[model samples]
Target: MSPTPEAVDLSQQRALADWLPGRLAAEQPAILVLGDVMLDGWWSGSIERLCREAPAPVVDVQNRESVPGGAANTAMNLAALGARVSVAGIIGTDDAGMDLRNQLVAAGIDVTYLLDHPDMVTTTKIRISSGGQVMLRIDDSARSVPAEALAELAASVRSAVEHQHAVMVCDYGTGVLADPVRRGLVDALAGRDRAEPGVRPLLVVDSHDPRPWAPLRPDLVTPNAQETARMLDLRLPEGQERVAEVSRHADALLEATGAGAVVVTLDRDGTVLLRPDGVTHRTWARPAAEKQASGAGDTFVAALTLARSAGLPLTASLDLAQAAADVVVHQPGTSVCSTAQLSRYLKAFADTALEAGELERQLELHRAQDQRIVLTNGCFDVLHSGHTRYLNQAKQLGDILVVALNSDESVRRLKGAGRPINAVADRAAVVAALSCVDYVTVFDTPTAAPLIRQLRPEVYAKGGDYTPEMLAETPAVEEYGGRVAILDYVADRSTTAVVNKIRDGEGAVQTN
Candidate 1:
């Protein structure tokens, strides 16, 4: 599979930042989560002594926390991303089940379909931690749903699927994926596929026994390295040709399962997405030396499902999902990532609204809309009223205003080391946030002349202080039938003066 040329980076994050909020607010995607629902309980304390009888560390419990686990965690993740979420799963008629349902409801998830069975015990995984490390774990649960409960659960899922845009089956070796229920869901999805055609609800399966889901022909299948290896009955590949090997394995899995796409998560090595359209996208994991990976996989699937349901492209969805997982894995204990957390994460990384390559593509897209592109270059290190006024006037000269910012290295080379108190990323983010700027990109050159020629904007703009003859990029602008427009700056409004006054311990003064 050939990878898409425009890799997802800060540019993609900006687009998502704009696209996701609106989509989430205006056209929320409803999703149904069906599978095993468990409660994850944790006890953290300090350990200073060992047990006299058993020779085990004795942890004096100080605090305890409970969170939704298993498939319920996936539902929580979806709600955290602002998706309209409902969960359909089985739990025991016990305190753990009640706690799990309460947490899910508190997270704004619809838990009406979560049924309780008298005979079955709710799956509970309890961890005892001391000094920030897990000392021991005790598990209490039943893996299988009562035979009599399967029919009712299946009926609930079938009814729920009709109203949702997607259905995610999270089978964690639980009997929730019983043959009868699985078959009913598959038929329901098949009917949806036929009735709605292109807009049918997506069927996504993340299961340990992936082969059972093969006949269902799910739209997407997510399997980890070990799960993928076990399902395909093959040894995991390492080093040198790992990418190719994993890609090949993913292809075989897709073929075997009849899934439209397969995502094989390679732990810290990152994730690989394979689509039958012959597009393969791979994203690296964010740096984390120490992390608690509990519930990270569920977070990944939830984000990916929501992004795809909101109509984002496959590559963008993959990148965003991976980013969400990255945020959760770095936190302590089992955690769910909120939309605000994701936005902050992306903003920090992609300071500039666009990268150079992304800027080029965005320009082309604008040109297609018959929008006139106005170009300007500046340090924009410390935005003052003068800069804002100049940018606003420049925007009026054309339909779209593109700002080319100088990189930190270039600024240091030209304006001395003391210049640019803010880094390039911060400067770019500040400029891009302005309403007058249509796009912002950082260039690593002494002058904008080279970039000017490449962009070939319709109108090249500058402040009144610089005449056409003194500017190095004038000729390049003229070469593309683009004339220079020098707008008057706000008098006495200079960033240098602002800095000087602050350094001199002067009082605040109006510059513009």
Candidate 2:
């Protein structure tokens, strides 16, 4: 067997972050979710003391909330991430079923395929929490899907998956994904793929049991460690060997199931995605001291499917999915990650640093929205009022301000040794955090001419009382119909003067 490959070190997060907004704006990809749908109810109250009857604490219920769970939860996540999602599954003709449908509809999911069964009871997991801690979980579920109901659901699944960009099989072992229904879904997807060739919708499976799904030949299957181990009939690996062990087990899963890829989620350790070509991509989990890992897996698979449907590569999709899971695990209850939350989350990680290509991708999207770009360059070694005012002026010139800083080597060559008080990463972060600056990137050149050539901004901005004739990038700026704006210099604010003053003990150099 081939050794597990290292995770793809591509800037997938940055790429996905740059790609998402435009994809979301251009089109809302449709996804069909099939399997067991459930309602998750939360009852919360304050627990003051132990109950007088049993050992359990007495809880006075003050608030009651219900949300979609199981396959429905997956659909909710896809919808929350801006996918045009539709749900196809069996639900009881009860209050929980009605509530589940309402919640799905409220989240902008199509419930046309959500069939109601008179004999079945809507699956529900009611969690009671006291003082922010879950005290008890009461599960109300029906294990059997009537044959007629299953046939109806299979028909619904077939029709729903036809027009969707992707299909998600979210099986919780709830009998909704029984053998017959699974085979029907598989046949339906196969027919569609055969009919459309390269245009067929991608199929992703996240099942409690991986065996039944294996024959479906899903494009991707997300299995937790135990599920993957169970499918392979192997024990979970322990300690330092976990990564390698999981990779090996994922290999077995792929061979056994014939899945195009297998994503083994190793709880807090992170996730490993194994492709058929013997490539394994790993992503480390985002850190959190306290975790609410209840709905993290659903969040992950949903984002993964959505990103893949949006045409991002598997690496970018995995990055976006991992980031989405990280966001959900830090929140309470079985919650879905919203698009705004995801956008903010990606921004937090990508803001500190970005490559020029990623920045250009972002710029393209911004321009698509008619947002004019403003480009500026500087060492920004030690931020001061001069830099702040300069960046502020640049921001006024366009809808977005992009600051491209020189690399350490470039800075050293231009300003001599020991000139940049802060490293490039640190400087980029500092500039990125400023309110006036919209994006930050680093260029390994003595001048920003190359970056200017790539960006071709509507306005090229400069500060510190420099005339256009003195700037070498003037022709490059004018080449793209970009006008140069030179802002007034802030008196007594030069970094050199500040360093000289501090060197001579005239005063302390203030950093802004």
Candidate 3:
């Protein structure tokens, strides 16, 4: 009957969509991230005329801004997703570094581990764009970080791990994720004894090289198709057997690195997650019509951590994480995916199913709503009332409330592993379900400006702790006549304080 349904594609989908919204509403999940963090800068306008001095087309230079890229972007994605995020990484004592710290602090991430390294130039990526698509990118930074800086950063990460729910390493081949720091970070999260489930600190990594990571044996690892191929030293699965090849590669990765699971990202196709059970599940991309794919991966990992922390099964987590990815890929440039966006995507899919290109049409309709959206985002690793009271009140001041979620890499760039208490999808679901939320999105940048411009919200909101003049969002939000609104926050109601209190034995630490 009906071809036996082929595969159970979306039961857990509904559950995941509802999960994060519930978590955000309830206020829970703490995520710790350790790794590289970089500043992503961009200049976008139009090629209205050609440069007189050169053959290159001259852009009108309509806009210029910066956001966290690489691991920092991943942390930002996690924070946007509603995770109680804590970041640990090395930053140069420079303007860019200061900017990065302010971005994290404004988004609700714990920046105690975000260290200051003198003389090190903050890693930054400058992209020149035409319209919304990227044309070229330039990297500015040093390759090897000073040893002393690495040690200090690692120490801060170690301290955070003793109190976090999970550990994620975002390696961008940058100096912050130094070899020694990587090893020590792994050691900190490694299972103490065989009977203890390889330590309560679930180890997750997203790195370029496999050799450095093999010894640590992470709990989860995500690499793009190219990275997977390089890691395995072979051409990955292609054609009909792609799934099998990925599954084999995932198992091989697990065996090689001692990780618990492997999630290989396939561009144009989708993401395939290989379980330790040797099962391979494929989640196809459900991108919105005429959208861009920027910070989609960061959002995926951030939501994934939140989901797992929420006690969701792997399949459910994968389903929801993929759903969150679909939402982010549609936004312009590196952006954040908030719970509202996730919820809208879910509700749209649940109502008409993700078939017949209904989602694309739905997204267009929402954009046409003409609301001055107030966008503020973070990785609510663990949902908490503090976040709720703040978000709920902020939503009341805007026509549509949008949250930008940090990807797992963004989480790591800011927080050392041990974070996004909930998986990405679970976090997205928690925010989506909230009545105050209007749309949710994900970004890989440390700052929400890129996404803010893309959405062009009428208003920007933040916690009472910071004024609009001090906000990194002021420039972007004000450019569009959108005013920045600051909501009053409860004193000491924070993810960092909660995590510290737990470490101090405030109550029982329950993972599930």
State how far residue 456 of model 1 sits from its true place (Å). Answer: 30
Among all windows of ten consecutive residues in candidate 3, which has the lowest summed lDDT? 1-10
Runs with alpha carbons beyond 4 Å of true place in candidate 2: 1-22, 291-293, 350-512
Stronger candidate by TM-score (1 vs 3) = 1
Q: Determine which window of 10 residues in candidate 2 has minimal summed lDDT.
A: 1-10
Candidate 2 per-residue lDDT over residues 219-284, each given as its tens digit:
888888888778777787674357688776655788776789888888676677787776556555
Q: Please, what are the lDDT tens digits per residue for candidate 1 over residues 253-316? A: 7887779899888767667777776656665566466644488889989988987787655655
Model 1: lDDT to the true structure: 0.77
Q: What lDDT tens digits, residue by residue, belong to model 3 across residues 168-232?
A: 78887876787668766766655233335644766678777655787776678888788888878
lDDT of 2 at 50: 89
| TM-score per candidate | 0.68, 0.68, 0.64
Clashing pairs in 2: none
The residue ranges of model 1 lying beyond 4 angstroms of the native Cα positions read 1-22, 193-198, 239-241, 352-512
